[model samples]
Target: MPAVCAVLAGAAACSGVPAGFERPEQPVPTPEGYVDASDPQPISEIAWRYGPAPWRTDAMGDPRIEAEMAGIPYAIEFYGCDQGQGCTDLRFVTRADLRDSDDPDKPASRQARVWQANRWNLERRFGKVSAGEEPGELILEMNATLAGGVTRQNLDAWFDWWRVALTEFQDFTAR
Candidate 1:
């Protein structure tokens, strides 16, 4: 049967449509000019939203965005990508040097830094914190998964959480 349509209040309304012939609903709301949540976002999309960040390719050729938040330098490292498909995952990484409280000129011992990281991890469950590769350095990291796609609004919320995590870590290390 042909779909019956009507004009109501200058708006088009349809009815009597077959079960499989109805028009699809509008997509979920996303930020202006950003892709819908169901769409796989390319690196350029991310950089467009958060950029002016310096872009550099890693040894494996995946792109990374160098940026900072709350005075802490960090990198948005992309993973699981190719020339065809965009990256499926990304991580925000920041490393801060730790100093011994008793001796301002000295670096904190690895055991001491690990213990502090453990305490913070147990108390707060947002981002993961650990000892960095270098002595007396602590690493803070957060991950985002794009394999299933992510909404730009949700991504903004994640960045908000990252700022909070970084601030808390800075205060914790200072104390």
Candidate 2:
């Protein structure tokens, strides 16, 4: 009985630190609020939070929401989605189509568009600016990771940041 008790105590102590390393703390999942983000219903609520947004399909047929931010039309897309497990990330993207002259004869220079994107990227931290595949198209994107889930307040704050960033970008472009 003494030998068995001694072995159990030794095992318990060894479990605390294995191979001279402390057990890493596990990450606590962010609490879910009114909606269970894991399900797709929260997506409609998300769209509702930002005004009237219509559901659309992306090129690949994945669900996309058309919403306007800072008076600019943008698409909200989901990534890392599993039919059984649900989506883990959400992205908001907009394409600013530019034309140098009112006349279709001339198009905006790629260099100018790239330069603008580079400037936006250098100046901003919330959203990323990039030159799109098409000429004279500038892309702005913001992404949110929902790996563990998020609180309603935090999610609202995230939307707030997106709006602020979009407004700032619009102002920047106007200049």
Candidate 3:
């Protein structure tokens, strides 16, 4: 009986599982045209960097930026205290007639796919993202607290990053 017990222990040790083996890595879908926000440009210097083609203030007087890929539009609207108070939040939004499908499940399923894909990419850069839907739009939004008091310099940097990140996200959704 002692020998039998010893054999069982040996067999257990010999099993294929490693002592610290974790689950296999699952494949994740990466958004096409996704840009890493490794090097961010300060907002104040944006005019000198990009030549000011698609960036402008919207009708509401908030800063608005646009990005397009495959003829699809993606926009970022910045909101915060007036003047150089700095932006506290930004919304990345896209609109599609997902509800046009006769089958109700189709829109919901598509929304879920977009949400999942964008969520994965956004989380990598900005940590947690709040995702949801409006009447005719899908939105992924993030809020941030500036390390220092809201200043024009910080706002510029934040906007610059948002433009690049939102453009990348828009490209991903276009695919």
Clashing pairs in 1: none
Highest TM-score scorer: 2
Which parts of model 2 are misplaced by more than 4 Å?
1-37, 56-61, 83-85, 101-105
Cα lDDT tens digits, model 1, 1-175, are 2233334522433435757765446423444554322333344355445444566667777777777665666777776677423565678777878988789788889998899889878999788989887878998888877554556666777777877887887787776
TM-score of each model, paired residue for residue: 0.68, 0.70, 0.37
Tell me how many clashing residue pairs each candidate has: 0, 0, 2
What tens digits encode model 3's per-residue C-alpha lDDT throughout 51-73?
33265667766666564433446
For residues 1-175, write the lDDT of model 2, one tens digit per residue.
9999999999998767567355335433546463333455566566677776777566665567788755677777877665424566788887776556555555568887788888888888899988888977778899987666777677777778888788777776554
> RMSD in angstroms, candidate 2?
10.5
Q: Give the TM-score of candidate 2.
A: 0.70
Clashes of 3: 2
lDDT of each: 0.68, 0.71, 0.47
Model with the higher lDDT, candidate 1 or 2: 2
